[model samples]
Target: MSGSFGGQSAGGAKKARIEIIPLIDVIFFLLATFVLFTLSLDKIQSVPVDLPQATPAARPITEDDLVVLQISEPGTAYWNRELISSTEIPRRLLDYKATVPAPRVLVSGDDKARYGDAVLALDEVRKAGITVSIETAFRATGR
Candidate 1:
């Protein structure tokens, strides 16, 4: 078979064209991916804490040893083994001479005790030129 070619004198020439649909689709897909990533942000979680319970120790109280100041739930306070008013703590402590050896104060408060009472007791003990430490009872390991 014989064929006739179009154009000027012999072979034909044409300008190449590029398709834009695929390019446009790729751009849209990237934009959608970025938008989704930005929309789904990270989240955090937290929890509240509860104070721990204390166990009673198997020991006895003695005088001229480590002094323990207990502030009971009813707002009553004790110095060593004696029940004394809050105001009398400083005077009694001051009257105690260095020769008698004033003992370290251990302020023990009830679970439902007021924070102010404990802090005030510590302040008074410090003012009386005495050292202080917090007392905690240890749980028994065996029966």
Candidate 2:
């Protein structure tokens, strides 16, 4: 009797083949998951409000109507070019709002001013219901 020492049957050994279908499916699934995650990153949650409509006959605002609120490095606040205390911001904002028909404010600060002082002034302006803008250009002195 002939002896077959190798663990192969009478048929020759089958060739090893790589199955790529499942690998392609797994790669596609990972790509899809990453795409979906990236798409959701920019979702913004915000409250809805009814915005005011503009009129064609509305009067244009002049430079004289602009109010500049400046904050200094020493934690003092300024209304236009006048120095003021921090505690007086809210009262002044409210008074300005009541006096000006279309109140507008420009919040500015010295380059070395405290961030909290500027934010405090901005918060007061918002609470007074006035239109506000920020001054991005910095000056050596608070103005």
Candidate 3:
């Protein structure tokens, strides 16, 4: 025998209902957390420059002996991090040569930069009799 209150059985229980709004909020919060976490894990160590694409693949260089030479569209030149004039290239290369035999210099020219600017940079390096190479992006093989 069951007791009745207001014409309803007292022993009967109501079905539990899930609040969809709160569940959706919890899911969005988790999604945001993962997105922020993934973005923080990527570390990019590179100078801002637009590299030109080339048919030849880019060669990987790990030797610390290699020096970075950056040439922008406005004819600005930077050796490693120090900005220098075109006239200063030979002097700097010579100074480096005295310490390291057969110094290898990597010239990174902006895609929008004048071709003559790159030539001028290379000319100075050649004048100093140093081996120099250019940095280029390898052509993408697939879509």
Highest TM-score among the candidates is held by which one?
Answer: 2
Task: For model 3, name the residue pairs that clash.
Answer: none
Candidate 2 residues 16-122, lDDT tens each? 56889999999999999999999889778999999999677378888777899888866587788888888888888888888888899999888768888888888
Candidate 3 per-residue C-alpha lDDT over 6-97 given as tens digits, one digit per residue, 9 for 90 to 100 = 54557676545778999999999999999999999969798999988866525554576688777764646677867676667778888888
After superposition, the stretches of candidate 3 with alpha carbons farther than 4 Å from their true spots are 1-62, 138-143
lDDT for each candidate structure: 0.67, 0.83, 0.73
Candidate 3 residue-wise lDDT at 11: 63
Among the numbered candidates, top lDDT falls to 2
Backbone clashes in model 3: 0
lDDT of 2: 0.83
| Model 3 Cα shift for residue 4 (angstroms) | 96
Prediction 3 global C-alpha lDDT: 0.73
- TM-score per prediction, in order, is 0.45, 0.58, 0.47
